[model samples]
Target: MSAVLDKPRAKAKPKAAKSALQTRLDAIFSNLKLGQEKLQLAHQSVEMTDPGEAAEVLLRTVIEDMLPASIAPMRREPLARADVDAAYTGMFPALAAMEGVIALSIGQVIEATLREAFAHLDAANAWMDFTEMGDVLPHREDITEADRSDNDLAARQPAAAETENVAGCIFDAYERTIEAFAILDSRVSDMNSGAAYGARSLVKVAVDATSAADETNTRDNCEHASCALHEAIEVLTLVTDEAPDLAAEGALALLVLAKQLLDDNVGALP
Candidate 1:
């Protein structure tokens, strides 16, 4: 009778369902990880003999496959404030790597792919709560450090001129402008504001102009790139006015160098 008096076992608690935002964040992080792995594999196995095609394939994978897949869930549920910074930071390495590849690869096809990718990224930014994210410059620094570390092996080899060509210059300028934009975007309480959208549109135009310049090594294209980059600088000034910081200053300086390189090369061109 005493043995039969053993207390009944407590019912197990049901697991709490993950919030939509958490689910979306998990999807994004998973896709990014998978995309990075694919990128690494492509880097190792794919021959650079056909760099243009290789670049196109890689860009397509990120833009069409990875990016869309990641952002699709976020469209349904806004990303949590705590998750936004990590999302952006996680995406940067892949996008930055693709940018470098795009700079190196000579072709017209990659331009459309890049524009599409940027558009997706811009849309994803709409889902983020930048106000709660606070300062994102440190995330940029993390990206820079990762970049430097990744290039450590390459640093042992002969140095490549970063702004050797007009396309390279445009990409360099684009990179700076985007970096500054990220700082501004993070600081802004409302990314959906007209001013923020305008700044983003300017950056998109700059990207389109850069793609145009990259498509063909022509004086006209170079001039277009110069003008677009200049507009980007003006936008950057607005960004700096909104949020003055070292990152913005540094971006402005580098953007000037990129523009100068484009101008010098354009002038030298017949």
Candidate 2:
């Protein structure tokens, strides 16, 4: 009977304003959400997607933080026409200024890519909305060769043709990734001794890969080295807050790795 009588008392309890500590906690959670949003956007710009920090691994996957360490290697070669073509032809239909041929030099190819990047920038700024990309932009999801369907190649000819802007997003993302890697590569000092040692090991692997005499084997080894350096970039990207030097060192190591690959294979260039 006493328990039943307490129901009326519970209903009569008055609501009260939040306490000072509760208010402070609310503000903290709001700020955290906003910070999380900005961080996600940064990832989208560089990685072409936002895998939000659902876990500790996701927190450091952001390329913007890793960029301070990777810039040098990204600019080392500036993506020769062959390298551009090798990396993107499957998705881009063509990697040069023309169809079925690579007549444009590396300078021309890189300039064209930059032009697309600037145009995208101009349009986005003019509209005052960066997210208004105007079309289905490139994402890492579309990067694999197997993802390049017959439909993409049939979309347009001369991937850089002025009549269509299909390849704009792909080239822009490519340029940004290069810039991020380059920036990170140039500031590679103050790294932890252990991380420095690990980076050196990657460099040694690239050196050994470059020393291969057989053409096919050399190219295969270079491919593996590129993948390894990419993984290193992903790893160092997490050290942006605690030990940025590690991130920078990793970026520089990636540049060295790329340089070795290009230098070793220059003989194959057309």
Candidate 3:
């Protein structure tokens, strides 16, 4: 009887260990950490020195945020070509221009502007990533196909519908960010063109205004033009604010960036 009791006790320890492993596996399967991980990865990816690295990170983030949880269960694509094309179109040009400016500019002013622009881009990307992730987590398969499938499916089954809606909102935010970047790029181009004819040096830029009235006009026009870039950024900021899933730190990063660019350019105006 003692021998049998000892054998059962030894077997019980193995069963307990097996049960613990199963419990851990269940916890992992039910975990909601994917969303957190996606955002964190997006943040880190943006910090990379290489533009290619940054771009890869951005692309991976978008895919991760958009992908459904159970790939084997649902055979649908995560993102449409049109949506992917639009997103790339919006971000790539500005990203390239930022890289160019970083290479070209020698002084502190350019460095500061470059820093601000990248910071804003990173923030905007992170916010979008978060919002998109909010959409398709719990009922991952059904929620992601919301745009493609019937409204009845989405409306009748409301498990992850809110998450899908949040994803849509995130897409909209990125669109607005694209618009803001366009505005900034165009404005900067105009400024460079204007500068080409106006003055070569800071002293010359300042001295170009012969009288107080001339100085006022030059400052007013250039400053307003430069400030308009920030106005666009402010509108983008508002769009981000409208998103319920927006990260607060990400939003603040954008504001800090916009203010820095506006102040730098406006201050440089003669």
Candidate 4:
């Protein structure tokens, strides 16, 4: 009786392995669902904010949060907004001088993030495939023959559609993320250009306002144009301070890379 019971228990091993593989596949689907929900929240956040504030918030978010979340931890501290801005100011003879450097550096960051994102995506797909196919490992010949006819037929028909749907969802999330990053890059470029031009314009306005002040350069109540330009500058200052969430995600990711580089070469200037 003991020998017979042991024999039956041994035969149940393949079934147990198959059940484990199915469980893993379920977990993969659960994670995919959670990822999709997070993507939706990100999209809603972008859609809700005003453009300038949105841009600033996005920039801050990328630099401070999203990047760190994405990458492996580094020993060095990430570059803060003050650090990047100070670097921007110091490196440029004028704000306009920063155009090329900002474009190139930020562009590279965007590209690298997209590359890493795709790599992550491919890894996820590989895992999903493993979970889906692993059950056949034990009863290879029988499973193969059975799946060959049945799965082949279904795979060519409904299974193909199902696979495409899953792939589409995955690709859609990735594409949207990349697009968000691109928008952020564009926003930063625009904001920099606007600030440069605005600064030059403000200087001219100030000079005119000064000249008009009593002709002796002593004044009390400011003129209309100067006051307006000053107000504009204030708005821009607020913008710089705020930083948009979408841009923040990308910026944070770049800083994570920067942190890694910094950690490897300690005490090096950024």
Best by TM-score: 1
Report the number of backbone clashes for model 1.
0
Candidate of highest lDDT: 1
Per-residue lDDT of model 2, residues 117-179, tens digit only: 323322322322213333223343444554444334532342234224322322222332343
User: Candidate 4 at 71: error in angstroms?
Assistant: 23
| Rank list by lDDT | 1, 4, 3, 2
Give a tens-digit lDDT track for model 3, residues 206-246. 22222221234344643443344344434434443453111
Cα lDDT of candidate 1 equals 0.49
TM-score of each: 0.34, 0.27, 0.21, 0.25
The candidate 4 region of ten consecutive residues with least summed lDDT is 92-101
The runs of at least 3 residues in candidate 1 whose Cα sits more than 4 Å from the true structure, single-residue gaps closed, are: 1-193, 243-254
**What is candidate 1's lDDT per residue for 131-228, written digit by digit as tens?**
55355323323445555465444433322343345456555545544443444344344434555556556755766665666567578887887898
Candidate 4 lDDT (Cα, 0 to 1)? 0.35
The candidates, ranked best first by TM-score, are: 1, 2, 4, 3
In angstroms, give how far residue 164 of model 3 lies from its true place.
Answer: 48
- Can you give the lDDT of residue 261 in candidate 2? 34
lDDT of 4 by residue, 44-144 (tens): 44336533333333433333333322321111123122322333232212111112113323443233433333233333333444333533334323445
The models' CA-based lDDT, in order, is 0.49, 0.34, 0.35, 0.35
